[model samples]
Target: MIFFDRVSKVYPDGSVALQNVTLTIEPKEFVSIVGQSGAGKTTLLKMLLAEEIPTDGQVFFESSDVHDLGKNEMNELRRKIGMVFQDYRLISGKTVYENIAFTMEAAGKTDEEIEQDVPHVLELVDLSSKIWNFPKELSGGEKQRVAIARALVNQPDVLVADEPTGNLDPVNTYDIVQILKRINDIGTTVILTTHNKGIIDSLGKRVIVMEKGKIIRDDKQGKYFI
Candidate 1:
């Protein structure tokens, strides 16, 4: 569903975030990207999202070159990719329902659609009862769940989770991982970048390990090796 063809990114001041990274992510596949800090894991995700233009090579999403798209085209393409971050990134004033509703609202969804889909996605993240709560009221796990629900509100073809479990305890991390797995089981392509060794080993899925801005290892049914 996504391809990075010899992509490289060099920052101003002579820094390289990625170096000739080539990868293919199949549809409905759950892929984990594991690496230490500054290993280029996040850069790969940025390339997919077209958030950073590669200094060389191309990035393709379902056959369309992402870097070649215009503003409006990029906007349209981005609607098909959902992103979850290490930080919850929720609006402090928005209720759980409103936080999820905000994305749909931005997409020009109607009140009826928002009414129907918001509750469904909340249920998917197992936070149906917290719909009325604010961000400050939830635990770290709950906040991340809300972030996941917000990301899924659009029903994107691929979900990119960048360190989604970074701030939670083991039990909460397990819960979040299970939620991600459930989403993948239902056919959403999941791209997760995490630092947790236990999360990687427990996944037992395809793993791509990065080092010094390059892909060092790619394994199917892989475990934590970094």
Candidate 2:
């Protein structure tokens, strides 16, 4: 579903984040990228989501080269892609219900549709009871769950999470992973970047390791080999 051909990203100051990294992720598959900081993991995800243009090589979504898209076209592509960040980028002032609801509303979903869809997705993330709480009132895990619900409310075809479980305790981390797995089961392609050893060990899926801005290893049923 996603392809990178000889992708390399170098910052303006001559620092390399990704070096000629080539990889592919099939539809409905869960691919985890394991790497230490400065290994270009985020550079890979950002390129896929059009947040950054690769300094060299190409990034393709399905059949189209993303770098060739216009601003108008990229917006359409973003709607099909969902991103979860290490920080729960929630609007602290908004209630959990409004947090998820506003996403569909912003996309021009009707009031009725928002009301119907919001509750359904909240249940999916097991946040039904916490729907009325504000970000400050909820626990770390609860806040992250709210973020996940918001990401899925758009019914995105691909889910890209960058260090999603970084701030949570083990119990919360486990919960978040389970929710991600459930979403993946429903056929959304999942691309995750994490430094957590246990998750990479247990998942046993495809692992792409990047070092000094280059893909050094690519393996199926991959391990956390640095």
Candidate number achieving the greatest TM-score relative to the actual structure: 1
Per-residue lDDT over 184-203 for candidate 1, one digit per residue giving the tens place of the 0 to 100 score: 99899999999999999988
Candidate 1: stretches off by over 4 Å: none
TM-score each candidate. 0.97, 0.96
Residue 89, model 2: lDDT of: 93
In the range 118-148, model 2's lDDT, one tens digit per residue, is 9999999888999898999998888889989
Q: How does model 1 score by TM-score?
A: 0.97
What TM value does model 2 have?
0.96
Largest lDDT belongs to which candidate?
1
Mark the regions of model 2 whose C-alpha exceeds 4 Å error after superposition.
none
| Window of ten residues with lowest summed lDDT in model 1 | 71-80
